[model samples]
Every structure is written in C-alpha cells, then in structure tokens.
Target: MALFEIDESSGLPVWVQLRNRFVYLIKTGHYQPGDQLPSVRTLAAEAAINYNTVSKVYVNLESDGYVESVRGRGVFVRDIGGKADDVRSIADTEIEGCIRRCLALGMTIDEVTLRMMDVAHRLKDEKS
Candidate 1:
C-alpha cells in the first residue's frame, strides 16, 4: 500500500491530492536526499491510480526540482530547495489551506488567532 491515504470526497483533484501527500513525504524529512522513491508502477498499483497519473506526478516533481529520475535507477529525492521566494510561496499556500479549513469549521477570527499562536509556539518548542 501507499504511504498516504486519499480522500476522494475532499474536493481536491486526484493529482493534487496525491501531489500534496507525495510532497509532504519529502518536506517532512521522511524521504532524505538521494533516497529513491517507489517505482511508478509500484506506486500506481498501491494507490490504485492510473499509471499515467503516477507518471504525471513524477514529471511535476522533477519539473519543480524536488526530485530527479535516473535513467535506470528510478526516481530519487533532490535536496529540497528553500530559497526565500520558495519559502514565501509555500507559506502562502499553507495560509490559504489553513484559512479555508478554519472557515469551514466556522472558527471565529479570535479562535483561529489563538489556535495559530498555540500551534506556532508548540512547533517552535519542538524545534528547540
């Protein structure tokens, strides 16, 4: 089975849904630099997704510079890039995702603010 689960009802496109999970594996340090990813055929079979879809995901990952495909060695993780501009782009995406979920949960501005602060502090503590 795949390392992540998909929610078909989440209103996200299949590729997007898979992409987010796939990227998380990289971003979270689960897949280290030079670590090979599962073969496309293997991932496709595990996720029960189309082979084409898996190919598309790999292509995007390569285009984004997050991974590379060696001729016969399969795909491997690239050292993740985190330039200032890239950080900002990722932060914007994260903010939008958080806001959408908070809104859907009917959270008040004050509640969201507090929750954000609490989570931020907890994360900072964990890092320290």
Candidate 2:
C-alpha cells in the first residue's frame, strides 16, 4: 500500500485527512526527523489529489512544527522535541487515522468500534 491514501467518502476534508495521516506517521516514528517528505506536486500526483490540496497540507504541517520546507530542497520532518506534552494530541490523531483507514477499507463504524474495543482490551490486559 502507498504511504499516503485518500478516502473521498470520508467526512473529513481531503486536506484534513492528509494532515492527520501525516501527523500520525510522524508521531509514530514512521517519519523520522530530517526525513524528507515528498514534494507537493509529487505527492498530489501520487495520491491523485489536487496540487493545491497537497500544498495546503504541507503548509499546515510546517506551521504545526511537524516539518520544515527548505527552499530548493524539500520538506523534511522536524525534531518537534519532547513528545510528552503531545501524547494526547498524538493519540487522538492516530485514532482518527485508524478510523479513516478502516472506513476506507469498507469497514462500518460498528465493526471499527468493535475491533477498537477488542484491541483496547488486549492492550489493557497486556499492561496488567
């Protein structure tokens, strides 16, 4: 599967979906600091989305301090530093990304909820 996927049917706007996915990847360590992200045009073409949409996402990511775009170079993930205070926000972003993925894969909300509950229970058990 591609690193970036879009769900047109999702209630979330395309830019929002893209933004949340980017944050989730960064926070999860899938995108390490200094790792270069795809150029706006490249990612737009790859995701079959509009250039402006990708551009907006990249701009927002940069503003959020998740990445830095070096002129003539490319967008690279930033060392946002100290994830402690960001734990809640990161968790929310991840949950949203997971639900979006499940919906894109044709899972109903009920199915997603059940799966999530099961996973949560398993995680809680592991912590015991």
Candidate 3:
C-alpha cells in the first residue's frame, strides 16, 4: 500500500486532502483500474485518521466516477476516461487561488512564478 502524508496545517480539509492524494495516485498510475483499495477501516488505521473521514473521501471519489465500491469487497479503481481534464481543472483552480493569494500579499508576479517553480520542482523530486 502507498502511504499518504497529510498536512494538518494545510488549508484543505482532511477529507479533501485524502481525496486529492487518491486522485494523484490514480493519475500517476500508482493505482490502476480494477485494483482494489484498502477498506475504509484499514486506510483510516494506516493514515491515523477517522474511518468516517476515509469513507467520505471514498464516497466522493465514487460519485465522481473515479472509483467504484463492491459489496463485501473493497473499493476498486474505475476506468474513468477523460479524468485528466477533470484533474487539470482542479489543478488550475488551485493554482489560481494561490496566485490570487500571492497577489493579495503584495508579491510580484515574477516572485510568485519563481516560487511556484521551486515548489513544483520539490514536488517532482518527492514523487520520484
């Protein structure tokens, strides 16, 4: 199982954080179609979070067509075609929010761009 790190200090809610992590895994091919995910209880225990929190994240993913739940079995990754566009939109929205916040903080566009690049590099390194 892949481990996910949750930043309690981040502005995003825990459930959102969990959901985004799963999305990232799926997008990166860490999780593949028909692959079964750990049960909500197991995932919560491993993540050290509430079971309901994990459940809610899985439920939201299912509703978004990224995953499907099987009776008596766990959740499995679904063959969600065109999910890249959805992921891209979510990423664009997040970037826009960050840019807005940086502008509000009186940061120059160049400075914000540099910072974004630095953060992107760090994220790429972490993933590798």
Candidate 4:
C-alpha cells in the first residue's frame, strides 16, 4: 500500500494533510516510538509534495510533540504517553467539520450518522 496520499481536491493544505497523516500513524501505532520517519526529501518525493512543504510538516509535528529530529539523523516518532486525548480531539474536530458540512447540505443528523456507519463498515470489510 502507498505510505501517503495527497487529495488535491480536498481543499486542505498539503502540509496539514501530511501532518495529520503522520499524527494518525503515530497515534495508531503504525510508527512506534523511536521509529525513524522517512526523511523530508524522501517523503516529499513519495507523497509528490514540495520538499519545503514536507519540511514544514516535520517542524510542526516536532513542535506538537509527535516527533523529534536528531542532529545528523532523521525524524522519529515520539511516545507522547500515547496521548489518546490529543488524538481524540483531532478526530473530533474533523468529525464535527464533516457533520456541519453534511448538515449544510440538508442532510439530517440521522442520515449522516447512518451513512457514516455504513461507510465505516464497508471500509472495514474491504480491509479484511
């Protein structure tokens, strides 16, 4: 599977997308503590993003305590105490945004909830 993807049509900034994906990977244990992340240039090439943009994301991730960069070494994931609250907060914000967008499109809460659950199940099945 591809390590990263960029949705040009999502309207989200490229750096934000890369940062969020790194956060999700760290929170999901996909990249364990002390695991070295790909170098900025490598990730930029892999994700087809600008090298500067990837570097900015790395800086932001480091500031947020999700990662650390060692001199002469690459960035690595930080433990951050598992920080479930932080992860949950990020997810909550995205979920709320999606709900608001759906509501603005005239979808009821029930419809959004049902559709979200259906998609979740479908994705789970696909993964299996």
Candidate 5:
C-alpha cells in the first residue's frame, strides 16, 4: 500500500486532508481501478488519528462515487468516467469558495481575476 502524509497543524481538517490525498492519488494514477485501500483502522493507525475520522473520509468519498465498498472486501477505487458535468460542478464550487474568500478580504473582482491569471500562468509554466 502507498503511504500518505498528514499534517496535524494544517488549517484543513484531518478528514479533508485524507480525502484530498485520496483524490490526488487517484488523479495521479497512484491508485487504479480495483485497487484496495487500506482499512480504516490501518489508515487511522498509520495517520495517528481516530479511526472514525478516516471512516468519515471514506464514507464521503464513496458517496461522491470515487470509491466503492464490498460487503466482505475492502474499499476499492472506481473507474472515473471523466464526466465533464461532474468536473465542472466541482470546479464551480471551488471557484465560488475562492471568490467568497477574496470578497471577504476586500479584494475587487479585477484584482481577483488578475491574481487568478497570474497563478494560472505560473501553474502552466510549472506543468511544462
């Protein structure tokens, strides 16, 4: 099984960190279709967190259609269909959250757009 690192001091909750890590693993092909995930107990032990926390992350991922659990077997990664609608929905939600945060910080739309473009360009360059 692959190892995951968790930061105890991060602003994000532990469950969110685990969920995001799992998503990143799936997206990066570190975990493939039918790959068995570590049990909640095992993952919790490894992460030094409560098992319930890991369970919550797995439950959310399963509900989101990213994984499936079999009665007698461990959880497995599902085949992501690359559904554009689902992708767009997730992206829209994330963008909305970012916009809200920027607005709360008193940033104007133009300033936000400029900063977003700058980050986008940097990401594009990094990818290249």
Candidate 6:
C-alpha cells in the first residue's frame, strides 16, 4: 500500500511534496536503506499524479544522494548521514545559510532576531 497521499490543497509543488514524504519515511525508519520503493509507474498510478512528476521526484532524490537506482532492480533509500537528528541538522544548515545571506545584505543581528520573534508570535497567534 502507498504510504502517503499528497495534499492537493498545498501550494507546494508535487515533486517537493513527494520528496518530503520520502525523506520523512526514511527519517522515521518506515523505509530503511535497501528497501525498494514502489515502481515509478505504480506509484504514479496510485498517487493519481502524472508519471513525469513522480519520475522527476525520484530522479531528484537519487541525485541528492537520498536514493539509488539499480538496473533491473528499483529505487531504494540510501543511508544519508545516519543521524536521528537529520531533520534538525538540515534545518539548522538552511537557517544558517539564510542568516549568512541576510548578514551579507547588511541585515543586523538584532533585526533578524526581532523579525524571527515576530514571525513566531504570529504563528502562536494563529494557533490561539
């Protein structure tokens, strides 16, 4: 059975959604390294998405070193860093990159801190 269904209502691209889903599956130990993924055609038919979309997602994942494709075999997850805190590591790396870019643009530490706090506050308000 398919493990996840994409959220059609989300503004994110289908490929991005697929990529996130597979990543989460791996991180959560739902898909271990060497576990074969459903064939692209099968998955596309199941997801009711275009074949090209799923193919692109798989291709991108393979290129990102997240998955491997073997001739006459199938796509399988790769052992990427093997850290339980992989998500946090990724988030920290991306956030650090953003902070560096902001700093390069002459943004101040206090400005960035205040803006982040405001964003968090807005999120908290939304949950209320």
**Residue by residue across 25-63, what tens digits does model 3's lDDT show?**
787677889999889998899889898999999999999
lDDT of 5 by residue, 10-125 (tens): 89998898898888777667788899999999989887879999999999999999899997899999998664255457778999899889988999989999999999999656
Per-candidate clash tally = 0, 0, 0, 0, 0, 0
Q: Tell me which of candidates 2 and 6 scores higher on lDDT.
A: 2
Error of 2 at 71 (Å): 0.4
Model 2, position 4: C-alpha lDDT score: 82
The candidate scoring highest on lDDT is 2
Give the TM-scores of the predictions, in the order they appear: 0.64, 0.67, 0.67, 0.69, 0.62, 0.64
lDDT (0 to 1) per candidate: 0.82, 0.89, 0.87, 0.87, 0.84, 0.84
Error of 5 at 121 (Å): 21
Worst 10 residues of 2 by lDDT: 81-90
Off by over 4 Å in 1: 81-128
lDDT tens digits, residue span 6-105, model 1? 6665798788888877787787677889999999999988888888988999999899888999998899999876532554578889988997799789
- Tens digits of per-residue lDDT, candidate 4, 1-128, equal 47687766678998898888888888877888999999988888887899999999999999998899998998988887847467778789999999999999999999999999999999756644
How far in Å is the alpha carbon of 94 misplaced in model 6?
Answer: 14
Worst 10 residues of 3 by lDDT: 80-89
Q: What tens digits encode model 6's per-residue C-alpha lDDT throughout 3-103?
A: 75777668999889998988877776778888999999999998898899999999998998888999889999888766547876888899889788878
lDDT of 3 at 100: 94
Go through the candidates in order and give the C-alpha RMSD of each one to the true structure: 7.7, 10.1, 4.9, 5.1, 6.9, 6.5
Query: Which sections of candidate 2 miss by over 4 Å?
Result: 84-128
